[model samples]
Target: MTLPRLFAIAILSLTPGLTAHAGGKKGENSGISFHLQGDPSDNPKMIFEQNTAGKQVVYRRNPDFMTKDVAAFNSFPSQDGQGFGVVLQLKPSAKNRLAALTSANIDRWMLAMVNGRKVDAVIIDKQVEDGYLVIWKGIGQAEIDAFDTQVPRIGEKKPRR
Candidate 1:
Protein backbone atom coordinates (compact mmCIF):
# COMPACT_ATOMS: atom_id res chain seq x y z
CA MET A 1 0.00 0.00 0.00
CA THR A 2 1.19 3.50 -0.83
CA LEU A 3 2.24 5.76 2.08
CA PRO A 4 -0.27 8.47 1.08
CA ARG A 5 -3.13 5.91 0.97
CA LEU A 6 -2.24 4.60 4.44
CA PHE A 7 -2.11 8.15 5.81
CA ALA A 8 -5.55 8.92 4.36
CA ILE A 9 -7.04 5.79 5.94
CA ALA A 10 -5.55 6.67 9.34
CA ILE A 11 -6.96 10.20 9.25
CA LEU A 12 -10.39 8.98 8.21
CA SER A 13 -10.53 6.52 11.08
CA LEU A 14 -9.63 9.25 13.60
CA THR A 15 -12.26 11.67 12.30
CA PRO A 16 -15.21 9.92 13.95
CA GLY A 17 -13.46 9.71 17.32
CA LEU A 18 -12.49 13.37 17.19
CA THR A 19 -15.99 14.44 16.27
CA ALA A 20 -17.51 12.37 19.04
CA HIS A 21 -15.11 13.80 21.60
CA ALA A 22 -15.91 17.34 20.56
CA GLY A 23 -19.63 16.69 20.82
CA GLY A 24 -19.25 15.18 24.31
CA LYS A 25 -17.99 18.43 25.79
CA LYS A 26 -20.17 20.11 28.39
CA GLY A 27 -22.75 22.76 27.35
CA GLU A 28 -22.66 21.79 23.67
CA ASN A 29 -25.78 19.64 23.26
CA SER A 30 -26.03 18.14 26.74
CA GLY A 31 -28.51 20.61 28.19
CA ILE A 32 -32.28 20.03 28.38
CA SER A 33 -35.04 22.14 26.82
CA PHE A 34 -38.82 22.07 26.52
CA HIS A 35 -41.07 22.81 23.58
CA LEU A 36 -44.82 23.21 23.42
CA GLN A 37 -47.10 21.81 20.75
CA GLY A 38 -48.08 24.16 17.97
CA ASP A 39 -51.30 24.35 16.07
CA PRO A 40 -51.56 23.03 12.52
CA SER A 41 -52.01 26.56 11.30
CA ASP A 42 -48.96 27.80 9.48
CA ASN A 43 -47.21 30.33 11.63
CA PRO A 44 -43.67 31.60 11.17
CA LYS A 45 -42.80 30.77 14.80
CA MET A 46 -43.89 27.15 14.55
CA ILE A 47 -42.23 24.15 12.96
CA PHE A 48 -43.39 20.67 12.03
CA GLU A 49 -41.70 17.68 13.62
CA GLN A 50 -42.24 14.01 14.31
CA ASN A 51 -41.96 12.57 17.78
CA THR A 52 -40.18 9.31 18.63
CA ALA A 53 -43.38 7.40 17.91
CA GLY A 54 -43.41 8.84 14.37
CA LYS A 55 -46.52 10.85 15.12
CA GLN A 56 -46.45 14.28 13.53
CA VAL A 57 -46.14 17.05 16.13
CA VAL A 58 -45.96 20.74 15.64
CA TYR A 59 -43.93 22.90 18.05
CA ARG A 60 -42.48 26.33 18.26
CA ARG A 61 -39.08 26.85 16.66
CA ASN A 62 -37.66 28.04 20.00
CA PRO A 63 -37.96 26.30 23.34
CA ASP A 64 -40.37 27.48 26.01
CA PHE A 65 -37.66 26.96 28.62
CA MET A 66 -34.08 25.74 28.74
CA THR A 67 -31.30 24.93 31.20
CA LYS A 68 -30.73 28.58 31.95
CA ASP A 69 -34.19 28.85 33.45
CA VAL A 70 -33.60 25.99 35.87
CA ALA A 71 -32.93 27.00 39.46
CA ALA A 72 -32.52 23.44 40.72
CA PHE A 73 -33.51 19.86 39.95
CA ASN A 74 -34.32 16.51 41.49
CA SER A 75 -34.02 13.05 39.95
CA PHE A 76 -35.66 9.82 40.95
CA PRO A 77 -36.17 6.31 39.68
CA SER A 78 -38.94 5.95 37.14
CA GLN A 79 -42.06 4.01 38.15
CA ASP A 80 -41.64 1.55 35.30
CA GLY A 81 -37.95 1.19 36.19
CA GLN A 82 -36.79 2.06 32.69
CA GLY A 83 -34.82 5.20 33.49
CA PHE A 84 -34.68 8.19 35.79
CA GLY A 85 -37.32 10.89 36.05
CA VAL A 86 -36.36 14.50 36.65
CA VAL A 87 -38.17 17.45 38.17
CA LEU A 88 -36.85 20.84 37.18
CA GLN A 89 -37.56 23.96 39.24
CA LEU A 90 -37.59 26.99 37.05
CA LYS A 91 -36.53 30.51 37.96
CA PRO A 92 -39.20 33.01 38.96
CA SER A 93 -39.61 34.56 35.53
CA ALA A 94 -39.67 31.21 33.79
CA LYS A 95 -42.04 29.83 36.40
CA ASN A 96 -44.67 32.45 35.66
CA ARG A 97 -44.24 31.96 31.93
CA LEU A 98 -44.58 28.22 32.26
CA ALA A 99 -47.70 28.59 34.36
CA ALA A 100 -49.27 30.85 31.78
CA LEU A 101 -48.26 28.61 28.93
CA THR A 102 -49.60 25.50 30.58
CA SER A 103 -52.84 27.19 31.60
CA ALA A 104 -53.41 28.54 28.11
CA ASN A 105 -52.41 25.39 26.31
CA ILE A 106 -54.18 22.77 28.34
CA ASP A 107 -54.69 19.52 26.37
CA ARG A 108 -51.72 20.27 24.16
CA TRP A 109 -48.49 18.30 24.27
CA MET A 110 -45.36 19.42 26.03
CA LEU A 111 -42.13 17.78 24.90
CA ALA A 112 -38.93 17.25 26.87
CA MET A 113 -35.87 17.20 24.71
CA VAL A 114 -32.36 16.28 25.88
CA ASN A 115 -29.27 16.44 23.76
CA GLY A 116 -31.50 17.59 20.91
CA ARG A 117 -33.52 14.34 21.04
CA LYS A 118 -37.18 14.19 22.04
CA VAL A 119 -37.13 12.04 25.18
CA ASP A 120 -40.64 12.31 26.55
CA ALA A 121 -44.00 14.03 25.96
CA VAL A 122 -46.83 14.83 28.33
CA ILE A 123 -50.28 16.27 27.91
CA ILE A 124 -50.92 19.54 29.69
CA ASP A 125 -53.88 18.53 31.83
CA LYS A 126 -53.81 21.48 34.20
CA GLN A 127 -51.91 24.66 34.84
CA VAL A 128 -48.64 24.35 36.73
CA GLU A 129 -49.12 26.66 39.71
CA ASP A 130 -45.63 25.93 40.96
CA GLY A 131 -42.42 26.40 39.03
CA TYR A 132 -41.72 22.70 38.69
CA LEU A 133 -41.88 20.60 35.51
CA VAL A 134 -41.47 16.87 35.47
CA ILE A 135 -39.90 14.68 32.83
CA TRP A 136 -41.35 11.34 33.76
CA LYS A 137 -38.71 8.99 32.39
CA GLY A 138 -36.04 8.08 29.82
CA ILE A 139 -33.32 10.10 31.43
CA GLY A 140 -29.91 8.41 31.35
CA GLN A 141 -26.70 8.83 33.30
CA ALA A 142 -25.08 11.02 30.69
CA GLU A 143 -28.00 13.38 30.86
CA ILE A 144 -27.87 13.41 34.65
CA ASP A 145 -24.20 14.28 34.52
CA ALA A 146 -24.90 17.05 32.07
CA PHE A 147 -27.63 18.39 34.29
CA ASP A 148 -25.31 18.30 37.29
CA THR A 149 -22.80 20.38 35.41
CA GLN A 150 -25.38 22.85 34.16
CA VAL A 151 -27.65 23.17 37.23
CA PRO A 152 -27.35 22.46 40.91
CA ARG A 153 -29.25 19.60 42.50
CA ILE A 154 -31.89 20.62 45.01
CA GLY A 155 -30.48 20.99 48.54
CA GLU A 156 -26.99 20.03 47.48
CA LYS A 157 -24.26 22.07 49.13
CA LYS A 158 -21.24 23.54 47.47
CA PRO A 159 -18.07 21.51 47.63
CA ARG A 160 -15.66 22.71 50.26
CA ARG A 161 -12.61 21.96 48.11
Candidate 2:
Protein backbone atom coordinates (compact mmCIF):
# COMPACT_ATOMS: atom_id res chain seq x y z
CA MET A 1 0.00 0.00 0.00
CA THR A 2 1.06 3.63 -0.48
CA LEU A 3 2.79 5.30 2.47
CA PRO A 4 0.10 7.96 2.96
CA ARG A 5 -2.65 5.39 2.72
CA LEU A 6 -0.87 3.14 5.19
CA PHE A 7 -0.45 6.10 7.51
CA ALA A 8 -4.13 6.94 7.27
CA ILE A 9 -5.08 3.36 7.96
CA ALA A 10 -2.77 3.29 10.96
CA ILE A 11 -4.25 6.47 12.37
CA LEU A 12 -7.79 5.27 11.77
CA SER A 13 -7.05 2.00 13.46
CA LEU A 14 -5.60 3.83 16.42
CA THR A 15 -8.34 6.43 16.60
CA PRO A 16 -11.73 5.36 15.45
CA GLY A 17 -12.88 8.98 15.30
CA LEU A 18 -9.97 10.12 13.16
CA THR A 19 -10.90 12.40 10.29
CA ALA A 20 -9.08 13.79 7.24
CA HIS A 21 -9.17 17.45 8.25
CA ALA A 22 -6.85 18.83 10.92
CA GLY A 23 -5.47 22.39 11.16
CA GLY A 24 -5.76 26.12 13.08
CA LYS A 25 -5.01 29.79 13.22
CA LYS A 26 -3.44 32.30 15.56
CA GLY A 27 -5.50 34.49 17.89
CA GLU A 28 -5.16 37.54 20.10
CA ASN A 29 -5.18 36.82 23.82
CA SER A 30 -3.06 36.63 26.92
CA GLY A 31 -2.03 33.45 28.72
CA ILE A 32 -2.54 30.03 27.19
CA SER A 33 -5.45 27.98 25.89
CA PHE A 34 -5.46 24.61 24.12
CA HIS A 35 -8.03 24.07 21.41
CA LEU A 36 -8.99 20.81 19.75
CA GLN A 37 -9.37 20.27 16.01
CA GLY A 38 -12.92 20.18 14.73
CA ASP A 39 -14.26 18.65 11.56
CA PRO A 40 -16.02 20.81 9.00
CA SER A 41 -19.22 18.87 9.65
CA ASP A 42 -19.13 20.40 13.13
CA ASN A 43 -19.62 23.83 11.58
CA PRO A 44 -22.26 24.97 14.04
CA LYS A 45 -19.91 24.46 16.96
CA MET A 46 -16.58 25.22 15.33
CA ILE A 47 -14.91 28.48 14.37
CA PHE A 48 -12.44 29.37 11.64
CA GLU A 49 -8.89 30.07 12.74
CA GLN A 50 -5.45 30.45 11.13
CA ASN A 51 -2.59 28.19 12.04
CA THR A 52 0.98 29.38 12.26
CA ALA A 53 1.40 28.13 8.70
CA GLY A 54 -1.25 30.66 7.59
CA LYS A 55 -3.58 27.85 6.69
CA GLN A 56 -7.22 27.97 7.67
CA VAL A 57 -8.27 25.45 10.29
CA VAL A 58 -11.52 24.62 11.99
CA TYR A 59 -11.49 24.21 15.75
CA ARG A 60 -13.83 24.22 18.69
CA ARG A 61 -14.75 27.66 19.98
CA ASN A 62 -14.05 26.65 23.56
CA PRO A 63 -10.72 25.31 24.61
CA ASP A 64 -10.55 21.78 25.89
CA PHE A 65 -8.38 23.20 28.64
CA MET A 66 -7.00 26.61 29.54
CA THR A 67 -4.75 28.48 31.95
CA LYS A 68 -7.28 28.07 34.75
CA ASP A 69 -6.78 24.33 34.55
CA VAL A 70 -3.05 24.50 35.16
CA ALA A 71 -1.86 23.45 38.61
CA ALA A 72 1.88 23.61 38.07
CA PHE A 73 4.45 23.69 35.29
CA ASN A 74 8.11 23.30 34.34
CA SER A 75 9.96 25.07 31.56
CA PHE A 76 12.98 23.99 29.54
CA PRO A 77 15.11 25.20 26.67
CA SER A 78 13.57 24.16 23.40
CA GLN A 79 15.42 21.56 21.36
CA ASP A 80 15.04 23.73 18.28
CA GLY A 81 17.11 26.42 20.01
CA GLN A 82 14.49 29.05 19.28
CA GLY A 83 12.45 29.41 22.47
CA PHE A 84 11.34 27.64 25.66
CA GLY A 85 9.20 24.57 26.03
CA VAL A 86 6.64 24.31 28.79
CA VAL A 87 5.31 21.25 30.52
CA LEU A 88 1.97 21.91 32.16
CA GLN A 89 0.47 19.84 34.93
CA LEU A 90 -3.27 20.10 35.07
CA LYS A 91 -5.46 20.38 38.14
CA PRO A 92 -7.12 17.14 39.24
CA SER A 93 -10.50 17.89 37.65
CA ALA A 94 -8.88 19.15 34.48
CA LYS A 95 -6.57 16.19 34.44
CA ASN A 96 -9.47 13.79 34.44
CA ARG A 97 -11.19 15.72 31.69
CA LEU A 98 -7.96 15.92 29.66
CA ALA A 99 -7.50 12.18 29.96
CA ALA A 100 -10.93 11.67 28.47
CA LEU A 101 -10.37 14.27 25.77
CA THR A 102 -7.01 12.92 24.64
CA SER A 103 -8.22 9.36 24.78
CA ALA A 104 -11.05 10.19 22.42
CA ASN A 105 -9.21 12.61 20.15
CA ILE A 106 -6.18 10.63 19.15
CA ASP A 107 -4.66 11.66 15.78
CA ARG A 108 -6.25 15.07 16.01
CA TRP A 109 -4.30 18.30 16.37
CA MET A 110 -4.31 20.45 19.50
CA LEU A 111 -3.36 24.11 19.09
CA ALA A 112 -1.68 26.07 21.84
CA MET A 113 -2.45 29.79 21.91
CA VAL A 114 -0.15 31.87 24.08
CA ASN A 115 -0.57 35.58 24.49
CA GLY A 116 -3.16 35.42 21.73
CA ARG A 117 -0.80 33.86 19.18
CA LYS A 118 -0.49 30.36 17.85
CA VAL A 119 2.66 29.06 19.44
CA ASP A 120 2.39 25.36 18.89
CA ALA A 121 0.23 22.64 17.42
CA VAL A 122 0.56 19.07 18.63
CA ILE A 123 -0.94 15.89 17.36
CA ILE A 124 -2.76 13.81 19.97
CA ASP A 125 -0.82 10.65 19.22
CA LYS A 126 -1.76 8.88 22.46
CA GLN A 127 -3.95 9.24 25.52
CA VAL A 128 -2.53 11.63 28.10
CA GLU A 129 -3.64 9.85 31.24
CA ASP A 130 -1.20 11.74 33.45
CA GLY A 131 -2.80 15.11 32.71
CA TYR A 132 0.40 16.68 31.47
CA LEU A 133 0.67 18.63 28.20
CA VAL A 134 3.86 19.90 26.65
CA ILE A 135 4.20 22.87 24.37
CA TRP A 136 7.29 21.63 22.56
CA LYS A 137 8.69 25.02 21.57
CA GLY A 138 8.16 28.64 20.47
CA ILE A 139 7.55 29.90 24.00
CA GLY A 140 9.20 33.21 24.85
CA GLN A 141 10.68 34.19 28.20
CA ALA A 142 7.99 36.81 28.68
CA GLU A 143 5.33 34.14 28.42
CA ILE A 144 7.27 31.97 30.85
CA ASP A 145 7.26 34.83 33.32
CA ALA A 146 3.51 35.11 32.93
CA PHE A 147 3.11 31.41 33.57
CA ASP A 148 5.27 31.69 36.67
CA THR A 149 2.94 34.31 38.09
CA GLN A 150 -0.16 32.28 37.31
CA VAL A 151 0.92 28.80 38.46
CA PRO A 152 3.50 27.39 40.79
CA ARG A 153 6.43 25.47 39.41
CA ILE A 154 6.16 21.73 39.64
CA GLY A 155 7.40 20.48 43.04
CA GLU A 156 7.10 23.99 44.48
CA LYS A 157 5.06 24.35 47.65
CA LYS A 158 1.65 25.87 47.30
CA PRO A 159 1.02 28.86 49.54
CA ARG A 160 -1.42 28.53 52.44
CA ARG A 161 -4.92 29.81 51.87
Taking the tens digit of each residue's C-alpha lDDT, what string does model 1 give over 1-161?
99999998899797866755664553355478898988778585466575645678888757899988988898999888988999998899999999899999998988898877777889899999899999999899777876787677877653111
> Which candidate tops TM-score?
2
TM per candidate comes to 0.74, 0.75
Cα-based lDDT at residue 142, candidate 1: 71
- Residue pairs of candidate 2 with colliding backbone atoms: 24-50, 24-51, 25-50, 25-51, 27-116, 29-116
RMSD per model, one decimal = 9.1, 15.9
All models: lDDT?
0.82, 0.82
> Candidate 2, which ten residues in sequence have the lowest lDDT sum?
19-28
* Per-residue error (Å), model 2, residue 152: 0.4
Worst 10 residues of 1 by lDDT: 21-30
* Tens digits of per-residue lDDT for model 2, 89-146: 9999999999899999998889988876778898889999998999999899888887
